[model samples]
Target: MPTKPSVLFVCVHNAGRSQMAAAFLAHLAGDRVEVRSAGSAPADQVNPAVVEAMGEAGIDLAHARPKVLTTDAVHASDVVVTMGCGDACPVFPGKRYLDWSLADPAGQDVRGVRPIRDEIERHVRDLLTELGVETEGVETGGVETETEPRA
Candidate 1:
């Protein structure tokens, strides 16, 4: 079998946006891609809203938590995606980097978090396509949609 490509998503808090993106990628890729997420400044736990939103999409994110970014993570990934957290992620010499200007879902309610959820899903889909992975085609449930929320 071919070695699975790995991806790392980074953000300031790692509690919301990046976590959601990581979950989506893992789900869509279905083991064809290795997905990980971390924050420049780690939080104690993931945001409840993020969990709730993902759960609605039939994705379980309860096992996920905020993690601090490490040099090893950057080195391990075939692709490193960074959110709005600027200057926190180190520039690794040989890894591909992508900056996603995603809105933060830190303090947002479901009404507010909807758009962010949608954006993440879209990005996830595009990413899977780029990686040559097939979409899971599962209903987004209550968690996934096309909307943007305040950060």
Candidate 2:
């Protein structure tokens, strides 16, 4: 049997974007992928608005806490995704690195967080595809469609 690919999501706080990305990857990829998340400077807890937004997507992050980034984490992961963490993450030779430019959801309300959550989901789905993981049985919890403004 082939070993599962591991992915690490990193950000400055790990309270919002990284948490959401990790949850989406775990939920979507099931056991096919190993998901981890951390921050350069750890926060006390996951962002509440991020949790609520994820709840709307049917992923519970209520118990998730911010974790400090470590070199071991980067070494263990096949892919390392950074969300505005800048130079905080340690680079490894064999790891694939991706930087996602996303809005911080720290003080954002649920409404503000929803879009960021959805965007993370999209990126996670794309990553799954790249990793040769199928998302067929996963429930996406429905991303809201934007209506075009009539001129």
**Top-TM-score structure, candidate number:** 2
Candidate 2 lDDT over residue span 75-119, tens digit each = 999999999998778887888999999999989988788888888
**Candidate with the greatest lDDT versus the true structure:** 2
Model 1 local distance difference test score: 0.84
As a TM-score, model 2 comes out at 0.94
Q: What is the lDDT of residue 92 in candidate 2?
A: 78
Model 1: colliding residue pairs: 56-143, 115-147, 115-148
lDDT measured at residue 150 in model 1 versus the true structure, 0 to 100: 24
Give per-residue CA lDDT, model 1, range 1-151, as digits (tens). Answer: 7788899999999999999999888877777889999999999999998888777677798989899999999999999999988999999788999998988898888766767877888887888788888765655553345454322
* Per-model lDDT: 0.84, 0.89
